[model samples]
Target: SPPTPPAPSEPEPPAPPAPAEPAEQGQPFAPSPAGSAADLGDAPSQFPNAVPPTQDFDDDPQGFEQPAPSRKSGLRARPVIALALVLALLAGLVGGVVGFVFANRVFTNNGVNPSVSLGSPPPPGSSARPADSVAGIAAKVLPTVVSLDVAGPSQSDTGSGFIIRSDGYILTNNHVIEAAASQGSITVGFNDGSKATATLVGRDPAYDLAVVKVDKKDLPTLALGNSDDIVVGDSVLAVGSPLGLTGTVTTGIVSALNRPVTTGDSSTQDTSFINAIQTDAAINPGNSGGPLVNSAGAAIGINSAIATLSQGSSGSGSIGVGFAIPINQARRTAEEIIQTGKSTKPVIGVTLDIRYTGPGAKIADNAINGAAPVTSGGAADKAGIKAGDIVLSVNGRTVNTADELIVAIRSYKPGDTVTLKVQRGGSTQDIKVTLASESTTK
Candidate 1:
């Protein structure tokens, strides 16, 4: 402004040389030392805390920027960290592998093979027992046991039987041949591999017993043992045709004796009998008619029935709860059927004092009240007795309970006469009557 601002210089001092070119793009240019005063129009506005080229680490400003790390130093430090991480990972992997190997070794030492095969059959001749060493008892009893095959119209059944005498007499379950009895066929297979046709002599369904005869006489037979001598827990064996696989042998201990069971005529609304021996030895449909033997292999009872899964499927296999008819009862019935063509159980002439009810049976006065001295068309009816009479004793044995009467009655057989002391309306009288056989035909 002093020398009268020379008329605006040409091109205005080249616009102050457009300020020196900025150091780089987006940077303000530095002041040029040779610039005239007027060329340095107002300096560019200063930015707050902006870094300066001449600033020293000691003290150019209260805060300053730190220099960036050198590329070489950063690269060297990176390798050391990477190596340490790699070593740690490698050590962890080695530890895991060592632990797995040690654990597997412990399991293998305890008979656990992680990679072994199982469930395959043992090689032939490597059985647990010697093949040639037959049970001494089995050898003795096998000859007496026979396989029975009976064919009916609707069913073909197989059972087991045993020769009871040298002269062709055989013992088996009555149901075994019952179907065959109706114009069917019965065959017997002996232990010697010989088979023969057999004739059904007679059968008693009430007792679940039957007698048959084979053409071959003088066959080897087993002697019957007394079933009364048996007790609970006695070791026993079962010989039978299980699943139609003939000559099956199973061993067990006697679970119980005198076990009463209700069996027979599932189709009929009313039919059953009691008295049995229970054993855990397996007995199935085909096992019926087999022999329950002792360790000595003597026939003690006849296998008769099994606790079935259901009534409709009686042909299924056993579940260990099997029943056998006591040999004593069977022996009695078989002998009678063979000789008389029928079997009979003892009975008292007087009507039962009461229908079996409650824990123990008791006498009902009306059971004999207004009734004829004897039942019409019965052994008691023929004895000339009147109804309304109570039975006080039988054969001089006091009969307080119906069970007592049954026990006393079973002591005698049909055609046997017994004296009964009767109490009629507060008075007692003596009467005698002969027992009769129960009709076998329905």
Candidate 2:
């Protein structure tokens, strides 16, 4: 069976958990584990560039639910008692010999261990050794990176993010802070072990992007690179906190691009869709919202989610198949978010037949969810889009499914006119549709 949006399974807990506030009225609430969904919202994920993607990846947010620490019994266990007995016997036999050796060596080393020696300092103008290698890039980039500790009403989640502006504007995945929106807070920790409280600047769930601001001066920021310039097999680095370990860095190459994915909690039936940049980096649950930096220490993509081993994800970490939101898409969304309280999603006024299961997205004969198949006097309708017309391509880019069409349109901004290749009545014709915001199109 084809996988739907990510909400896979609830855990068989070591013990029953305490109840918490409901996400919605009449809904029971419990914390979820990493890469799992709690709300059940679904979103379509886009691939990088114009490469057409084939499948939907229900990428779950990392560390969905962190279990409570285990409690200890009052009594000592047999294992501890047995180890203590063995240690007692060994101590009596070796204590005098150990003391004699330590006393003699402590003075013979001239008050400092002879093995310790000062090495030559790094060359001037290049404090980072091998300045062209991945280690060098990490040395420069890590200072701009941060580990986010988001506290929710019920649980706290860990994820990664990077500074985009020296004024301390940081970008991260929306899901990383979604739970914190209500009665919660986020603390940003830096590579230097210093931490600061952050406030939400803006968020757009449709794009799975969020911008948060910290009150700090002279902060280091990462340089943004053009995602369009990246190619397959390009060297990339994924830096973030995975499993609560901060400043973790992994290296890999671009595996594929323009992969269409829809990930979120299926129970909520709400999700995000996108065309993603695929890489084989060791991205684990806590790696979400981190930057995927190019060889030059520029951010090319925002590390988002990793695909699990459905009988095959390697371990609890990444399976070498991780997906990132292209920085090109993130750059646009971030600007709009910072400028406005929310970002707009581009949409063509047409209801697609998702069940058509054809080569290209097929327009439904009538509207679904009370939306008009062709919005009256709207972009598509005005551009001569008719019901039952099969859309073959958008601006010359092939769209294989309704999800693809949606993601492709979102790759652009509202008011951007794009050409569409439509097939109707056994004939193919080019049509132009100026996209409008989903908020206004209906």
Candidate 3:
């Protein structure tokens, strides 16, 4: 006969936590830790780009009423108790490390090291490094960062911006004015508490950059720095009006550079943009157009987006995960926009398959061939490129995807010629096409 079925054991329920004491009315929420959410009766002026503090109730431990022990029970309680102790120890260690990292990344305001305790300094500070005195730098750079408010048709949006040219040229995220460009109004607010109307000069959605101009003269401007020189662990500062909170400053290190983040809504898979710099600085909703400056108070990147679980996500704001566009790219695009009233993106007149990964941008079709438009006897029609054509390479470099193709093509100017190797069905052929300026209406 089979062994007698073991007696049914009741399921173990989670231990209840100790009840928190009700706070006295009218008391302000204290900043406990980097991630703690203190109810100050209102949302933080800045997005609480911090983590919620872990509630350890051991100090007020309530006796857990464990299930009555049975002498005849097959299993002993010692093993379960030992396991709980081990798990608790592991959790404490992990939590401590996480808190330390978060404090270092998101809570260090005005360059005061959140990690250093009891007024202890790290070491003798260098002249060029950001010491515990970020107030001075903030004062110098705050005048350069501006708050951008846009009024769109369906909705209104706000973002941060920085003055780049003394003549009143401002730089901001292109998405801030995308709707406004279609139809709306744009304005800028300065750190000195002055608001002024602004005019949209030009915008480039491909790079998510926009240029705006104000009538004022002699505006303070931020010095542009080379983002290529940045390295992980380099101290940096983020200045912006997060969540409509104007002139907020946070400090952190350059988490990473040359980071790629997909931009654009998820619905349209056909179009997207990438390439960004990752920083642990606290960046939030209204921080989009703000400046990501280096220790020397120079603009290196433009704070654009934070990686979140979803859009309009609630709870702890910045998790030390933020991205920005390189200042070099923004500066070049802004100059072109200001001079020509638009960004002249260089384009190779070929339809490309961005998903192809073998060797080059596989040509699926050519929208423009020869000279005439698809309706007008276009040059593409005369060039003999048809549907089902795969572009193997451009010039000499292999184009594994459409993004690579775009990058290569953008490097060339309009009227310049480039050679493309194509795989027509099973056969390969070389074709030369003249690059075109994106500003062309056709």
lDDT of 1 at 240: 76
CA shift of 347, model 2, Å: 0.9
**Candidate 3 to truth, TM:** 0.56
What's the lDDT for residue 349 in model 2?
78
Candidate 1 wrong stretches, greater than 4 Å: 1-134, 266-272, 309-316, 349-356, 362-442
Model 2 stretches with alpha carbons more than 4 Å out: 1-127, 266-270, 311-316, 439-442
Judged by TM-score relative to the true structure, which candidate is superior, 1 or 3?
1
Better of 2 and 3 by TM-score: 2
Best candidate per lDDT, number? 2
Query: lDDT of each model, Cα atoms only?
Result: 0.72, 0.82, 0.74
The ten-residue window of minimal lDDT in model 1 covers 31-40
lDDT, candidate 1, at 269: 20
Error of 1 at 320 (Å): 2.5
Residue runs of model 3 more than 4 Å from their true location after superposition:
1-133, 265-272, 310-316, 354-361, 365-401, 404-436, 440-442
TM-score to native of every candidate shown:
0.57, 0.69, 0.56
Q: What tens digits encode model 2's per-residue C-alpha lDDT throughout 1-442?
A: 8868889688876876556444443222333433333223322132124322232223433423333233333134666988999999899869978987987776574576666669988776845577559889999899999999999999888898999999989999988987786669999999999999999988777778889999998999999999999999999999999888899899999999888877776466446776899999899988999999999999999998888766664566677899999999999888887777677788787888888997889999988889778878878988999999999898989988998888788878889999999999889999988887763100
lDDT by residue for model 3 over 1-442, one digit each (tens)?
A: 9999999998888778555554334333323322223322234445455443344323334522222234433345667888999999999999999998887796765777656668666898655634335776787799999998899889889999999989899999877766687778888999989999899887777667888899999999999998878889988899999999999999998998655565765463323254577999899899998999988889989998888866567775788899988787777777888888777655655565545565656555444334322222333434665665776677876766666666566545566788878787678988887666666110
Q: Give the TM-score of candidate 1.
A: 0.57
Q: Compute the lDDT for candidate 3.
A: 0.74
